[model samples]
Target: MPPETPPRIFAPDRRAAVRRRMLNLQQAPDAPRYLLDDMIEDVVERLAFLRHRPQRALLVGDIHGSLQAALEATGAQVTTVEPALGFQEEAPYPFSGFDLVASLGTLDTVNDLPGALIHCRQALEPGGLFIASFPAAGSLPVLRSVMLAADADRPAARIHPLVDVRAGAQLLQRTGFTDPVADARHLAVAFRSFGREIADLRAQGLTNVLADAGPPLGKAALERAIDAFSAASKDGRTVERFEILTLSGWRR
Candidate 1:
């Protein structure tokens, strides 16, 4: 057997963070997490526009279960890989069986993203479709700026490294997927306060998970970062831009 793959970037504890945050969202549906889910739904809607409805569908990383319900509404049987229940450690992966596989905000934090894409492709039948959307390169520049300003003297690794649009397409093709297409869409999430934005990030399970992250910001630094973020606001409100990159392909 090959040696265990060492994590390159994201911390192992991030898996636990993902589990906890997602569970809280399910238990309390008060936050506007659905707005973000719109990005994932857009990928599916693109497939639907092509009339690529599936008879058997799989949804990986469903944050609120709404995506699964929406897919089922089209009369497709759906299987959701809920993070809180664990990462399908015991489920059988029947190769070439699923007609469609869609994932939402899942790939960004994963350690073995390439292997994950391979698995996703393997699970698809001949000519089946796979679409995944995650935070890619050119995302969250404003947050990075704030993090740097917070610690201009000693910066801790606050953000995880992410893939960009072109690199994203290469991975799909490298995984032996066909006709790979990738694109980026911009979203400017408005926030009245930096703290509320942090809360929203927590609500969506998007937080610092770098394996080599130095340490959490000191109280003073944290306060300074918050101030910096707020100060960068336009017209008394902060607008954070996120480049939602979507990658799509079909099995050859």
Candidate 2:
């Protein structure tokens, strides 16, 4: 029998569109890059701590080009495959034999995450490293509460189901990665209003890309959501927390 088809939780086209839009916006002088910058810094720090120096590296989903520049500064030749160039995380990659592979802010949305992980592992030369970071479980609690209030009678799936650290470790081990490690970091950001939070999400290309996303909230529902969001604020500002899950492994 043929292999079973994976459930399509996210739309590839929508993902591509949002990522492309994000890349375009990243070119702007005032793009919101806190999340991306944080992830990049963490990855670089991990590389330094591990004492893993890559002669050739493959970087995925770096919209700002900062990560590539950092990798290059380490004397590693970096090759980037970004969504703006039609790179799909779930799809098979063409090139291989790299000492390091780093995927930032993209793997969480892939339908076939295990397959993607396998590909990342296979692309590495022996003993190569694989690192990825994305918003994971327990993220966006404030926005989630607002959305739930908005859909009072019928709460819709406004947020993507995220992977926790345990699952990340299991996925790495299942995909034949050795010495797998997974951890979470929380980032607290303050927003003056719900609309500003939404805007930040869009700027980071972290908006909903679910294939079966529900219809937009009606005026009354939107108002309720905004009000609920405001009600949860303190001193005219709401604090939202994002849990970034980082996964690392090495190919045997």
Candidate 3:
């Protein structure tokens, strides 16, 4: 008898396609997630950087940007919940016994950001640090402007609705993370075309959070948006700027 042949394989899923398209809007990957992850790792190597050796740590939320930073702050021996690798689906225990708890950029995305912070507080030992970073209110002004100018009839996107330096600090304090501190860094991302900027934004998992993202762009709107973006360009490149805020506090 002849062996049976397998059926044809399909391409990617529609949901995946949507995700990919949506992710393309941001000019960069979640900055707090990526950058802080590196910071964690690098901070670990130097003894002076440690301030104190962290035997155990908890990295709250899922932001690849800050993974390395968390790692650096917390040594390899340190146990981390929602561990970096294969950690997406895993939400380990509260880790209330940990010496340190670093949130990176998780809180902002939560529906109840304050509640999440409270949970972080509960998950740490007394006086343990709880650090985080989130896209500031000042982020993505240029992109927002272009979109708004292009589609005057439609409502603007709710792209960046998180804390800036002031709001982050206040939230930390309000959430009972004592001695809260916050700072921001303005990073400008330049793109050759508006399409590229939108694509990069999506790749970075940062894009319009508008309740109604609105219907598919009409030809006129697309052309208008492109024109507006082109006008915003400098030195032959369109620019999208973001002000990322890093915030931290300690459990009292």
- The 10 consecutive residues of candidate 1 with the worst lDDT sum are 87-96
TM-score of 2: 0.98
List the candidates' TM-scores in order. 0.91, 0.98, 0.72
Order of models, best TM-score first: 2, 1, 3
Model 1 lDDT, full chain set: 0.78
lDDT of 1 by residue, 1-252 (tens): 995784777765666676577567657748757435767668667876878988898887776677777778889898877555566422345544898988788777767777878888888888889988877787778788988998888887887788888899888888888989999887778888878888878777777777777687889988988899888898988988788889899997
The TM-score of predicted model 3 comes to: 0.72
Better of 2 and 3 by TM-score: 2
**In every candidate, how many clashes are there?**
1, 0, 35
lDDT of 2 at 186: 95
Q: Give the whole-model CA lDDT for all candidates, comma-separated.
A: 0.78, 0.91, 0.58
Could you give candidate 2's per-residue lDDT for residues 98-133 as a string of tens digits? Answer: 999999999999999999999998899998999999
Better by lDDT, candidate 3 or 1: 1
- Candidate 2 residues lying further than 4 Å off, grouped into runs, are none
Q: Which stretches of candidate 3 lie over 4 Å from their true place?
A: 1-50, 61-74, 78-93, 210-212
Candidate 1: where are CA atoms >4 Å away?
1-7, 88-96
Candidate 2 global CA lDDT score: 0.91
